[model samples]
Every structure is written in C-alpha cells, then in structure tokens.
Target: MRACFSLDTKTEAIPLVPLTPDTLASWLEAHPPRVRAWVEANGFKGKPNSLCTLPDEHGRIQGVLVGLDTEAPVWSVAGAARKLCPGTYRLDTDQDVAWLTQACIGWGLGAYRFDRYKSAEKPAPVLQLPEAVDADEVLQVVDATALVRDLVNTPAQDMMPEHLAEAARMLADAHGAVFSTVEGEALLSENFPCIHAVGRASSHAPRKVELNWGEDHHPRITLVGKGVCFDSGGLDIKPSNGMRQMKKDMGGAAHVLGLAKMIMAARLPVRLRVLIGAVENAISGDAFRPGDVLTSRKGLSIEIENTDAEGRLVLCDLLTEACEGEHKPDLLVDYATLTGAARVAVGTEIAATFTEDAPLYGELEEAATRLGDPVWRLPLHKPYRSSLESSVADIANCSSAPYGGAISAALFLQEFVDPQVPWVHFDVMAFNNRGRPGRPKGGEAMGLRAMFEVIRARFGG
Candidate 1:
C-alpha cells in the first residue's frame, strides 16, 4: 500500500489540481489558458471518481487531477486512487490536508486485496510518497488495518479455532509477549465453562488465547475479544442470508489484536493483556441446547435465550477472568460483533461504545475525533437490567425486550466486570455494506485506530 498527499494551492514546483465540475471552467478560464486546450483535447468531463493527466506542449507529464465526489468521506481519496498513474503530484489549490491526510491513509488501506489464496497478475498501484505525510506511520496504520481485515476476511476453512490461536501466537512471538492458551478440556479445568460449552461441539475444539506484556508496576489495560470463528448460530440456526457472512464474527479478535499490534509497535507504557475466546458455533449432536444452563468463570449460571447470542456468552467468562486476574487493570475494554441491534442503532460506519468512566469516554471521543476514526458512545442504562432476568438461571444470555437490543447486550457483559473498574464495551459492525474511500465494501477494521489513540494518550507512547 502506498500514498501521496496533495495541496490545491499554486506553487512553483508542485503541480496538482482538484478536479470538480464547478471549478473546471474557472481553472480553465484562468492562468496559462492552455489548461483549457488539454481539457478540450482529452474531453475530460470532470465527473466524480474520474481522473485525467495534465501534460505540457511536448506531451510530457506535468501533474494529475482526480475527481472526488465527497471530500473526506471517512475513507477519502479511496475511489480513484487505485486507477491513477504511478507518480508524485501536488494539489492545485489550498484545502485542509487533515482530512486528505487521513483519506490518503485510507487509499493505502483500500489498495489491500487478499491475494493469499491466489496471486494477482498486476500489483496494486502505488502513489509516489508525499512530503507532508509520514509515509512510515501511514503505512504502519494502514498495514495494521489490512492485517485485521485480512484475518477477518479469510474463510473459516482456513481460520478455525486453532488457527485463530496460531494468529495470536505469531503476534506474541513477534512482540516477545508471554503467550498462553487454555484449550479443549482445559477450558473446563480453567473455569471457562461458557467457552467450553460453546466450543465442545466442534471437532476443531474451543480455546482462549492469552498474551501479556509490560511491567507489573505500570497501569494495567486488558482487552477481551469474542472470537466465534464461524457462527452457524448453533441449534438456534440462522437463515441462509444471515449466515452468509458468519466468517467475520471473529472481527472482535481481529480488532483487539490489531490494536495490540499498534500498542506494541509504538511501545506504549502500560501493561497489556489480550484474551480471545476462539470458538465455532457449529451444529452437532453435542451442541448446547437453548434451554441449557451453563456456569461461567465468575460462578454465575446463565440460561441460553438465543444460541445466536453466543458472543456475549463467550465474553462473559473472559471478562470475569480478566477482571479477576492478578493485578486488576484500571481499565478493561472488550470489542465484539455481538448484536445486530447495534447496527440498527448506530449503523455500520460508527461503532457503538459505552464506558462507566467519564474521563475515559471523553478521551476516547477526542482521540477518535482527532484521528478521524469516530465511535459513538451509547449509555448502559441500569433500568434495562430487568430485561435480562432469568427464571431458570441466574441470568439469561439475551433479553426479552424488543427495544434497546444494543444497550441490553452491553448490560449483559457489564454483569461480569467488577463494579469499581472503569470499562468500555464496543459493539461493532465490522463489515462495510457499501464501498467508500479508504474502506472497501468488505471486512473492515472500524474502531481499532481510535481506541489505540485513546490508550496511547491515556497512558504514554
């Protein structure tokens, strides 16, 4: 992935121009008037997502003009970037590069195509590096995002429970973090009963990936991700349409791991603990029934209201285990593609995040705002707690209420965390329904950067 930043203002050496339909006539009418001749010769229409090369009298390449429909749409400059000729260019006028800076970062991201299974005949187009952009930092962020997208985009056949654990192991090895995993029957012995029950039905088996780093004396930050590798919705089967993209259910793990990579790369000063409960909600004779009562790591029994709601089940145990661990962290955060209710509430682009800590929430919001990777905070209303009450078990995995489904899901996870601990839960819709700049219409890394920025600011880099 490669990128270049541009300014529209005129300069002696740098020659780049913004191509908009409204500006086309004025740009042609003014300065060096031959600019009009080039438009006439090429029949350049200046349509959105269009591109044209500018040349001198001898037909030597001078600069380039790109048509952007919406300036700074979360992932800007992503549409026509891949189609441009490979070279360095500058903008013809002055516009804020803050959005362009982030947009160009996304072009590097959209350029990513998973060619692991098969190779591409032509390599992705790489833009000449720009002076204003930190090429290395842009590549690092874009590459990390691609890493998460690639991990989630891979099919379950290649990305199973063991494979997810292997991904963690590789990350741990790269960063030199202490890595450990509780697998198969060991999950029961380790008191991860929900994880055991959900995974026991699969031949691939269920496991938890644990990676820890930083000094014990530093502030502790724990991340718990729900890694339901392939969700068939278990006995509570999903329709064909609903299950089509189930491979991305483990997107939470990808996000946490991606964020962890950024933290480790930047060498932030805080103890980081990552927990992933990797499982497959496959159908078999041994699958847990909807009416079954399962004990969790926290000793609370929960009744299954919907097997489709397994993300919360896996997270409940891991959250308790994380909070109860030695040297409890001041902050604990979990990310998951837990509910469709979230997508309904906030849509796909903005992930729904909630936190008990005001300062933490404010910092996260500011970080997202600064980085242009925004996440909207949803409240964890206490009145909704009654919706999760269970007659058979201590609680139910899902709520009976039709309203506030996203809120109820957050409340369910909140039950596992210690009351005094400041925590955040992100209910993210990790896939993009429509293609846009920087973000292609496929598996994407939503809240990874914003969360990383917040942690970096709250602690240190």
Candidate 2:
C-alpha cells in the first residue's frame, strides 16, 4: 500500500468536510457556536483549495472545512494533502462516486515525494480509503505513475541507456512479459543503425528494449518511446541553459512504460509490444555530425541538418520496426520529448499530439476529455513535408525553418511510417517547470492515462 493512503476503513481520523461557496454559510449555521465562531474568526471562504479547521472548546480539531469549486478537476483536493499536517483524514461529503475516486487518486499523487536523493523532514498526510471507489484499481494507476516519475527523476548517471534496459527487464519479469535488448555493436547487427548512431558517442552504450505480452490471437498494439537518456545536442551543442534539464530527455520512455503497466495490469485484451530506444546525445570525437547522412533501419537515407534533432532518429528506427517489419499493430503510438516547438505552441502544461489518421486522433481526444487528462491535437500538415526534404538524402532530420517545427518534426517521422498503419505521435515536455496540485516541479508523465483509456475503449479490458 502507498504511504499516502490509510486503507484500513476503521482507522480513527479527522472528518474532512467539503463546502462550496454557496453552501458555506448554510453549513456553518448547521454547526454549533464554536464551529461557527472559528469559521468567522478565520474569515474562511469556500474558495478552491482553501481550508479552515474548526476547533472544539478543548482547542482540538473538531473537523476540517475544505473549499471546492463546483466544477473542480480530479486534482481539486490534491493540494490539501500536501498542506495538511501528518494524520489520517476521512472525507465527509455527498459528492458522487467519480468525485470520490478522483479525490482518492489525487491524494496519492499529491502525497508523492522523491526521497531517493534526500529524505523528507516529515511523512505526508494520509487519506483513509473511501468505500465508494475501487481501491485496488485506483492504486494500480498511482503505482504506474510513480514508476514513470521515479525513472524520469533519476539523474543520467543512474538512468543511462543500460540502466533503463534493466528497469524494463525488471518490469517484464514481474508481468510475465518477454524482454530482450540489443546494445552497442549489437544495435548495428540488429539493424537499428540510427539508435546506435545517436548513442555511440556516450561511454554508456545505447540500447533498444522490447517487451512483449499477451497472446498472439489478440488485437495487436505497439508502443514506442524515444529514450534519449541525456541530450547534449551532440556536435551542434545546445547552450548551457538549454542543456540544464536534459536528463528528462527520456520522459517519453517513462510515459510508455507507465502506459504499458496500466494496460497489462488491467489485463487489456491486446497483444502489447513496448519498444524503447535508449541513447545519449553526447559530444565526442566519433559523434555523428551535421550534414552527415545515416541510413535508417527502413533503408531511408536521413540527412542530419542538426545533431540537436536526434530524438526523431532514435524513434524513426523503432517506429519502422514496429509498423513495418513486424508486429504491425492495429494501433502504433510513439511518445517523445521530441520538439521544444511543441511547448512553444501549446505551452508546457498541455501535451501536443500529431496524427494523420483523423479517426484515431478523435478517439484520443475523447479519452482525454473523459478522463480529465489533457491533450491538444496538432495537424500533420502535408504541405510542411516540403520543409523536411533534403536534396542530398531522401529527407533531412529537420530544416532550418523558424516556423511550425512541431508539425515538421511529426512529418519527418511520418515519412518512415506505413500510411496503412494508424499512427499517433506525442511530442511532450514530460517535466513540470512549476509545481501545481498533483504535478511537482520535476520529471512527469503527460498523456499515458488518456492513452490507456483509448486502448481500453478500443480493446476490451
């Protein structure tokens, strides 16, 4: 059980009462004089995320009044968990089951602390498990999310390509998934030339991890993630400021791993295959340079306009293998911290997605909306394909254009994808620059929940 939750239903705890702006006055009237006086003294308003504690004559906490917006999100009460003193809290409210479930999940999310590097001064507040929601099911999502956060939060020294492969192996072992990998020179032998080219510069050898689960007769679903362990922009190096948070370059891999966990845990009826190409875009004497043409696994000649744009290279190979050579899935989705331009367009908070298949994109949007996990779809504008064209190679990794970089980057990957396959590509930030209710300022998982819902909707769980 997660430390954030008190699963024991009979545990003694404080009552956490929720109040809306209109009901605050009525609720105060219903309470005794001491409770009303405390409320008046504190000038408590039923504003979102605001809280006021009512005390008895003995100066002990009688109950807690937490303000909530009428149409609050899943994370409405998340901040309360972080702010509350260490103790167990039981919500006393009449909200529906959905609200109850979200509140529980939100508490778990907010209570998370990355204590691997440094211990916390105190343990987080705990919320008693409500009888209304499915505890095991909700905890599965929380555990999967924690997996993503832990992997992404680790520094490059501990989270290199080889380390990531081991992590995948561990996950595979637990879930009965068959895991295998090809690293260093083995990547070349396995025909993953682009993955090798990007990761070879690092002392830590680059690797590709593949985990296969589910029976052969089920509908096939393939997931690919770009696991650039730490990107230094190679020979076309980025400025120091740009390179500061490059440890999160593998956020895409974290997301796919998390999404895969959710799918497998639910026993979704699909032949699931997870592919991650882990690499480091480091500067070295042997590093692949600007204008260098490299042959992709699909035999497409790729011209490197800038080594900074290497996530696509790591992904192109895996994407090709997933959609073309084998495991031609009913759905092929790839996630990557591929483009900064996506952040420029959609801001860091919202995930920007690109897909040529309109119907597939619709399903994704529907799932995101239904689950309150957000995603904004960007067009794979065909005209932008001209921006990636190279006279030397079949296509350049990226053009020097100052516009529509996110769209163009998606177009570059689209070239390798078989048009017959329904494909969705996510260009994500995967890190929060600022803290919010449940989202801390570190490595984060962006769209996995929505992706899981989409998978479940298409293929029965």
Candidate No. with top TM-score: 2
Model 1 segments beyond 4 Å from truth? 1-30, 37-50, 58-61, 67-74, 86-103
Alpha-carbon deviation at 178 in model 2, angstroms: 0.8
Cα lDDT, model 2, residue 67: 80
Kindly list the per-residue Cα lDDT of model 1 for residues 222-252, writing each as its tens digit: 9999899999999999999999999999999
lDDT of 2 by residue, 329-436 (tens): 999989999999999999998789988777777888887776557899999888988988899999999979999999999999988888888888999999889998
Candidate 1 weakest lDDT stretch, 10 residues: 2-11
Give candidate 2 regions above 4 Å deviation.
Answer: none
Clashing pairs in 1: 7-91, 8-92, 8-93, 9-93, 9-94, 16-90, 16-91, 16-92, 75-437
Estimate the overall C-alpha local distance difference test score of candidate 2. Answer: 0.88
List TM-score per model, in order.
0.89, 0.97
Worst 10 residues of 2 by lDDT: 68-77
lDDT of 2 at 441: 83
